[model samples]
Target: MLSLIVSNPLFGVVLTLGVYFAAQKLQEKTNFALLNPLLISSIFIIILLSVTNIDYDSFNKGGSFLTMLIGPATVALAIPLYKNLALLKKHYRVILVSTLSGVIAHAILIGLFTFILNLSPEMIATMIPKSVTTAIAIDISNQLGGITTLTISVVIVTGILGAALAPILNKFFKINNPIAQGLALGTSAHAVGTSKAVEMGEMEGTMSSLALIITGITTVLLAPVTQAIIHSLYF
Candidate 1:
């Protein structure tokens, strides 16, 4: 019976959502910051796959469907954005400038690190878009000739870490402004981080959503330029 269920394509989808749901339940019950639903779900899924000896290719058969939902889920953020348009307008300059700065800084840092480490241009390409939303990052990585698989993995890790650390980091830095917090998460972590910001508050969610959009567009516009610069300098 277990073998039959595991062999089904939907097993990937069912198992992922099932574990995430269970993780969500735990988060609700425990109200622990580090007990993140996505984080917990990821750990449990890894363990399940390892224990069952299920290969990633087989799991991704149904898991790909969840990836499809990312676009629509990203669009849903528009609601909160609209609700907070006035706040966005009031902070438009700050949001715009901050996102732009973050993208530029991220590119420079990634390029510098890749150069110092003597990594390939392809790796530099893959690492450049790690901070943005997956949907947009995938496209940028493709155009930049990056390995899509590695890009996805790196992006996921970046998001998960961003989400998990945003709260703790904010506390440590004594940063309490909702707008700042939201932008920090969205700019550094993208959608997953934005999810955490949403849990923090409506203002944080809105700002994070706003930052996510801006950062995505900025990254799309500048990723190629950054890659070219990195290539000229290091490669």
Candidate 2:
């Protein structure tokens, strides 16, 4: 019976959603940043699969459907952007420049460090898209000849760290400005950080959504150019 249920595609979907819902409730009760729902649920899910002796391929049979929804979910962020049109217009230039800087800096640093460590081109390619949201990052990684699994892992770690540290970093740096906080989180952390920004305040959430979108677009467009530069300068 257990094996049969695990083999079913819907089992993966149900298990993920159920675990995430439970994790959210736990976080709500704990009110701790470290108890992040996504993070906790991810860990729990891995443990559950391991204990149950379930292969990832079987789990992904259902989980792949969830992955497909990520694209549409990303597009849905536009609704928030539309609602905050005036705020966005007010800071369009800052948003553009900040996000561009993040994309470029992220690319250069990942490329330089990976080359310095003598990582293969494929691994370097995987790390290049680590800052962007997974929806587009997977595609970027594939095109760059990266290992999609490693790209996904690195991206999640980046986002988790960004979300976890944003509040502490903000307090330490005395960054009170909502717009700057949002830009910093969204540009660095992607969607995970944006979720934390939403809890911070209206302005932070709005700016983060904007920054996240801009960061993704800029990364998509510049990844190839950045890759070429890395190839020339490092190789």
- On TM-score, the candidate that comes out on top is 2
lDDT of 2 by residue, 76-136 (tens): 8678778878887988999988999899889878877866798777887898899988887
Backbone clash count, each prediction separately: 0, 0
Residue 67 of candidate 1: its Cα lDDT? 86
Q: State which candidate has the highest lDDT.
A: 2
Candidate 1, residue 205: the lDDT equals 88
Assess candidate 2 and give its TM-score to the true structure: 0.93
Q: Which stretches of candidate 1 lie over 4 Å from their true place?
A: 29-32, 74-83, 168-173
Candidate 2 wrong stretches, greater than 4 Å: none
TM-score of each: 0.85, 0.93
lDDT of 1: 0.87
